[model samples]
Target: MDSFDAIVVGSGFGGSVTAYRLAEAGLRVCLLERGKAYPPGSFPRSPHETAKNFWDPSSQLFGMYDLWSFSKLDALVSSGLGGGSLIYANVLIRKPETWFVNESIDGGYERWPVTREDLDPHYDSVERMLDAQPYPFDQKPYEDTPKTVAMQEAAGKLGLSWELPKLAITFARPNEAPAPGVEIPGGDDNLHHSPRSTCRLVGECDLGCNFGSKNSLDLTYLSAAQRRGADIRTFCEVRAFEPVDGGFQVSYIEHRPGQDGDPAAPPLRGAVRARRLILSAGALGTPYLLLRNRSAFPALSPALGSRFSGNGDFLGMIVKARRLQEEGGDGELVPRLLAPSYGPVVTSAMFMPDAHDEGGTGRGFYIEDAGYPEFLNWLVENNVLTMSHRVGRFLLRRAWSAATHSPKSQVGRSAADALSKGLFTATSLPMLGMGRDVPDGRVFLREGHLDLDWDLTASKPYFDRLNKTMGEVSKSLGGRYWASPLWLLNRLITVHPLGGAPMGRDRREGVVDSYGQVYGYPGLSIADGSVMPGPVGPNPSLTIAALADRSAERIIDDHRRNPAGRP
Candidate 1:
């Protein structure tokens, strides 16, 4: 069996940061990522490439997108070296300090064991490491981004505070001016060892930034860890773990990459021992692994699989926004010229304060301008062709009648009008919302498979308020609004799944303490979204990393204080 000082499962924000911190402290660390590494320009774009971009070990398909379905919700998470950071929209907002509420709930009181003050320093460390920056909407070329302008207009008309949230993307090199669509000069140092470039504004952040513009874990934390001599093995999935003498034992499966012109490969079993083991395989993965190996840690908290939440995540769209004619010649409404697929996945956001603040409502949530790839825009444009054809027929008749009635013809104007009739897609935008929702959901092992028992009914009031705000924003933009397609069918879709082995003051309330140390198990810890005791009220990535930073400090201190074990 292979041995190490520490082992980190999953290479997302938590795992990557922990590995880097531990290795930087001179401890031998091994990071086992279940998915393969994705270098710049390697993400799938073509139909054939996209078809194979799913995670299914049984079918020997190891790809980025990992899709999961449950009775109440559907989830889409990334399965790559950088974990969800590879596919997530790079928003790095911090959790609101006042939004950390302590309230009674179904299972127990939903409270945050660690306060925002405690995480402030750690948050700063993560922000500096990520080199976070706001979208350069104030600069030329970017200043006229249609979707961002539309969202700003909507927020302005509603008298709301709209701001561009900092993003983990590389728009320019250090000390250089902001320039888009240029090669990032220092691109050779990343873990993937691929050339990278600045943002091309292709609206592909969520599908994985192929240009390496996004400052994902693979480029930031994991790269630094690798340079610090940490061992990072991709395509190795940890199956189970158990505490043992002076350390812990981890069993995993190594998946081999296919050779040239062939895609068939076999999985090989492996095991390793570590003085410390940190489970950071994301919210869903960590809890599932713990539940599967529950018998090994018999004294774990009962709240291991409790407090699961979608982070109050909700999606909606504003379609067919009304726009004025070109050159402002006439007052008649025309199809909006704004293109939702022209910027990063999200450019700007509006925050809705909670009741704690004056003149605010229930729980707070953020509504951001969501975008998609140009391919989706092309698909949307294709769907409007039939509508355009019908309008073309109508315009042809009008032109024919005018020509027959008058010596001079207005057919040119009529033809131009026909061509501009169908623009529903170019005028539309998607809004993503996530805030403090009831963390009442739970996860469990059923028939040796992971199952979620999450119901959105408990958070109906929060959802209703969030939806109303979204509708108001859409209405202000002169467009029709509707919930995400799955919402109507009573199903929620979330990319930011959080909580499971939540942090608490003691074992009675959570599986881990404020430092993310498992209460009863000394060397066992969890450093991921699974440690969030409640919803982060924003994009949880930054907060997850901050918490992991604190956890790593605690782990290093514990190691120095008691090198043998924590008996």
Candidate 2:
């Protein structure tokens, strides 16, 4: 079996960052990613393609989206060489300085062994690597993005702080003016070996950026790691690992594309040895792997599956928002063109600072304008009776004019009006909420499968506060508000699941130490959201990468001190 100095599992923010750092540090590194790599323009969008766009190993459907359902929550994550970065909205906000609550909440307390100050330099390093930049809303064409404007107006009315958060996207080449929907530079040199284009304002970031504008891991860390001589394998799913005499032995299944279609095809098994192992398979995956491979490490922390949280993610919508132009006007209510599907998945963010500040109650959360694809606009237009009415009226008028007037009577003007009139889709916005909620949820193995024991009863107040704030924002924008569909059933959905293996001062509190090393297992570390002791009060991707950067430094120092890889 091939052996290496370090092996990192799952190429998300954590795994990719670790791979790049270790490779740069001159370590013999290997990265294992279960999903296939998605080069530019490979993400599927058509109905037939999307129909099969799910992660199901039984049917051999290996797609990007991986959905999981628990008793209290539904989770959506990505499955690809780039991991969640391929499907994330590209927000790269740092964890708030004061929002790191180390005290107890309703259900359970949150404590972080590493503070914001400890991660400042690491955050800078990650930001530079990802090429983070704020959405250039001040530019001409982007200045009037309706959803962004509407969000800012609502925040101003509500007396909240609103600003454009940094995003991992390439809007223009170096020293060039910002332009959308144009050919991007540096495509030939990218790892994917595919041409890419600038962001076209398609709101398809969550669907995977086919244009390669988003600086996802595949374009950044993974590519850098490969260039630095890291061995990367895709479609190789790690089943389990155990510490051997001097190193760890990993067993995995090597999946072949055509082989999956044949029932009689035997499974291809593979194994490798590594002096050091890093688990970056994300919060749920890492914990599940450890729980299933529990016998391998009997001295693993008791907090293996403890401190689970959804990062207080809540989804809501603001529909039929009135334009600021409608204010103080005597004419009919002019619906604002929020046009939620016109820009990136997220463009601007409004922060609700935590109660640590005076005159605040529970923990604070962030609300951003969420977006979808323009195809969804057709569905939105079809759902509204007024829109159909306008189209129907225009068609009837066109038919009458053709019959009464010239045979070549013009319908172009009326058709344009019909297509544009009463379009409610242009006036809707999706509200994405995330912040600190109680981290009381627990993960455990049930009948040899991973299961979650979580309830919203204890965190009801926090969610209620979030919903009430969203309701107020909707009212301020003259729109109707609605929570997620699952909310009525007391269930929540989260894309940013955090904390299954958390960091602490010692084994009693966390599965890993401040440096993300397993307490009893030297040379074994976790550099993912699973190691978050508490919820990061923003998009957790940046923080996860920063933590991984820090963890990689520790691993490098340890390796340097003991060249033989002894702990």
Candidate 3:
């Protein structure tokens, strides 16, 4: 069995940062990622390819999306070399200073043991490593991106706090004008040895940027970790771990091609010993793993499965937005020229004050312009953009030309116009809102599988506020808002699932402590969204990375003070 100074599970915002920091400190670290590595241009695009993109080992399907459809809510998280960063929208907003609540929230979730001040230095360190930058909206071509302009205009008219949030995307090299398809200069080539480019305004950030414009974790922290000689093995899924005399013993399965998921044939497992084990398998993953392997850690905290939240995620779509014309009635409406399929997935964010804070209302939230991929526009257009009518009109015109024996040179032009940028898809916009929500959700193993017992009842008031505000934003844009179908059923999906092995002041309060050390276990730590005591009231990725960086400092200091059992 192979061994190391530390074994970090799941190369996410947390795992990647920890691996890099530890490797830099000259500690032997091994990172285990369950999903395959996605270099630039490897993400699926066609419907056929996308249909097979899911993470189900039993079905021999190891893809990016690892979905957990619990009774009340569905959670979508990534399982890849870079984890959620591969699928995220690349927004890097920090948790609000006031939101690092020193007291427990309404639903008995633990108070945050660490605060913004504690994470400030770590936040700066992670930002520098990821090369975070705001969308260059002030620049020429970027400024004219329709969704960005439209979002800004609507926020200004509605008195919402609007600003371009920082993105972990390389819009340009340092001190260079924003240009599409330009090579990004970096200290180390990404793990795949592929070249990265600046943002190409392709609206593919959430779908994995083929141009590598998004400064994803694989391209940044994980790359640096590799350079520092950290052993990074993808397609290695850890299944069990237990504390040992000197450290911990870990067991994992290696997923390879051509392996049949047969009932009779069990998977071949491997084991390793590490001086320390840091679990960074994300909010959904880490909790599920711990709950499933509870028998191994007999003295784990009672709060292991508590303090779960979706970070107040709410999705609502707005349609039929009007563009004010020179001559129109008091309430005339025209489809706006905002193309939602042109820029990165998210550009501008509108901030609403929280009741806990001095500014205003109920639990605070953020509404950002959630752009879609160019291909999704076609799906939207075909579903709701009068496709039948357009096809009928085209056939009629072509039939008329043929019957009249006319030279119809303009037929191709009409076909192109019908397929490109229809008003319905151009004006339709998805507003993504997330913030503080009641964190009373629980996760536990049922029949040896992970499940969550949570609902919208406790968080109803917070979501109501979010809905009302989304409705106002829609009306301001000359449209009506429709809640997502799932939301109508009081169910919501969250990419930012947080708090399962949450941190607290003591074992009675949480599973982990302020430095991410597991409360009862000495060398075991959790450095992911699973450590969040409550909702971060922001995108949460940056905060997760920052918290991991802070934890890494403690780990390095302890290692220096007491050299462990090593070769």
Best by lDDT: 2
Q: Highest TM-score: give the candidate number.
A: 3
For each candidate, the alpha-carbon lDDT, in order, equals: 0.87, 0.88, 0.87
Model 2 per-residue lDDT tens digits across residues 2-72 = 89999999999999999999999999998998888999888998988888778876777778888989999
Question: Cα miss at 138, model 3 (Å)?
Answer: 0.9
Better of 1 and 2 by lDDT: 2
Q: What's each prediction's clash count?
A: 0, 0, 0
Better of 1 and 3 by TM-score: 3
lDDT of 3 at 160: 76
- Any runs in candidate 3 off by more than 4 Å, and if so which? 186-188, 259-267, 327-332, 383-389, 404-421
Model 1 regions lying over 4 Å from their true place = 105-109, 260-263, 324-330, 383-422, 564-567
Tens-digit per-residue lDDT, 108-143, candidate 3: 544988888998998899889888889888888888
